[model samples]
Target: MDKMRAMELVLEAKSMKGLTFSEIAEAVDRHTVWTTSALLGQQQMSMTEADAVVDLLGLDMDVARALQAPADKGSLDGPVPTDPLIHRFHEIVQVYGTTLRSVIQEEFGDGLMSSTDFRIDVERIADPAGDRVRVILDGRFEPYRKW
Candidate 1:
């Protein structure tokens, strides 16, 4: 992926979104004229700036890195599988990473819940109202203090 090409694509795509250069720059959290001129191919992005541009544009990880360095194109033998259930689980992990971190810090006063020392168990229980699934999690704690 050429970084210059990616920037050009972003600039061209903005027209489809009906956004002005300044509007597009704000949406990407960059300075208006800088982002505009860069997108227009008036300036080349340094490696660090290119990385930030990639993140701002939400471009593919491979495409973003390829702007700075050569990218390895790995091959997959067959069709990629799509499982909604597994996708939901992945989403849960992503959201929970932040939410659980905040909750842990609040509960433990800037401490952390450790994955290395973690344990989990799941079981089904029969209740008068309904059958239910239960999960138990335990982990070691580590604290952080700021100077």
Candidate 2:
């Protein structure tokens, strides 16, 4: 099966099985965010990881093989996101882009964060009035090369 088709089957099986990303991640012994990303085709998976997910989701071996293929990455299909939730993230960068650049440059130097060597986390904070979600993007800072 193609990666996209395999991804669709995986999603269907996951929904039918009523399994959570956290559960799948635990079964594969991987971080939830990374596992989710791999399952969504943003990242590649090892043969073992892919097999475990395939077996857990009751999917075919073709899905496992597809998951092990190279990822295309950056799955967004437009210059600007139309989905409300995703758009909010784009809006955040639009609003804070300059400030974030300045802050990072001030603290780290003239450089960029390494998305290739990054980790993300999502957490829930309980409050008396409401619950809060915290998203953390942790990436290695790479100072600019002065060649």
Candidate 3:
């Protein structure tokens, strides 16, 4: 089956089984973000990981095979994302992108944060005004080599 179809099946199975992404990830012994991205068709899974997910989701081998296939990463529609949640992220970058870069550069020197070696954690913090969404991004800092 195609990746899109496989994603649909996974979503259906997840809903039918009332399984959270964290649960599925735990079953496969993987991180929730990576597992969720794999299920959403944005990341490739190893054969073992695929098998574990298929078993947990009660899907056939086709899906397991599909999970091993390479994904079309960053497949977003239009110039600006229309989804409100996604748009908020874009807005954040637009507003704080420079500030973040400046802070990181000042602290880490001339270098870039590696998305390849990144970990993200999301949490909720209680506040008197309203609940706050806290996102923690951890990535390796790679400095440019002077040739």
Candidate 4:
């Protein structure tokens, strides 16, 4: 089965089982962001992780195999995101891309942050005026080395 089909099955099973991503991650002893990415077909899962997910979701071996397959990362619909929420992220990068780059360069010096070594935390904070969405990105900074 293809990754898309596996993703559909996972979503349906998740809904039917009333399971949250966090719950699944907890069951599999993985970080929520990575688990969620794997479930959404953005990342590959290890054999052990696949087995745990399959057992938890009562999925077939095909699903587990699909989860272990290499992922086609950054599979977006178009150059620019159409979804409002996703579009906002694109907009943020457009606005702050240079500032972020400059700040990071100045602070860390001539290097880049590694997405492979990244962690993201999303939280909701309650407020009287309005609730706030907090997204924290933690990535290891890799400096450029002259050879």
The model with the greatest lDDT is 4
Task: List lDDT for all candidates, in order.
Answer: 0.56, 0.79, 0.80, 0.81
lDDT tens digits, residues 1-147, model 2? 777888788878988997877788898899876777677666789999999998899888899999999976655444768999998887656544444554476468799888999999999999899998899999999999977
Residue 132 of model 1 has an lDDT of 78
Q: Tens-digit lDDT track for model 1 on 1-147?
A: 564566566655554555565665565466765555455443445566566655655556554554444322211133333698665545444434443554465457678877799998889999999997776778888887678
* Residue 124 local lDDT, model 1: 97
Candidate 1's error at 106, in angstroms? 0.6
Off by over 4 Å in 2: 80-147
Ranking by TM-score: 4, 3, 2, 1
Alpha-carbon RMSD of each model: 15.1, 17.6, 18.0, 18.1
TM, every model: 0.35, 0.55, 0.55, 0.55
Worst lDDT window (10 residues) for model 3?
94-103
Off by over 4 Å in 3: 80-147
| Clashes within 3 Å, all models in order | 0, 0, 0, 0
lDDT, model 2, position 139: 97
CA displacement after TM-score superposition, residue 68 of candidate 4 (Å): 0.2
Q: Indicate the residue-level lDDT of 124 in model 2.
A: 100
* Candidate 4, position 15, lDDT: 79
Candidate number with the higher TM-score (1 or 4): 4
lDDT measured at residue 83 in model 2 versus the true structure, 0 to 100 = 100
Candidate 3: C-alpha RMSD after superposition = 18.0
* Order by lDDT, highest first: 4, 3, 2, 1
Model 2, 115: alpha-carbon shift in Å? 23
What local lDDT score does residue 73 receive in model 4, on the 0 to 100 scale?
Answer: 63
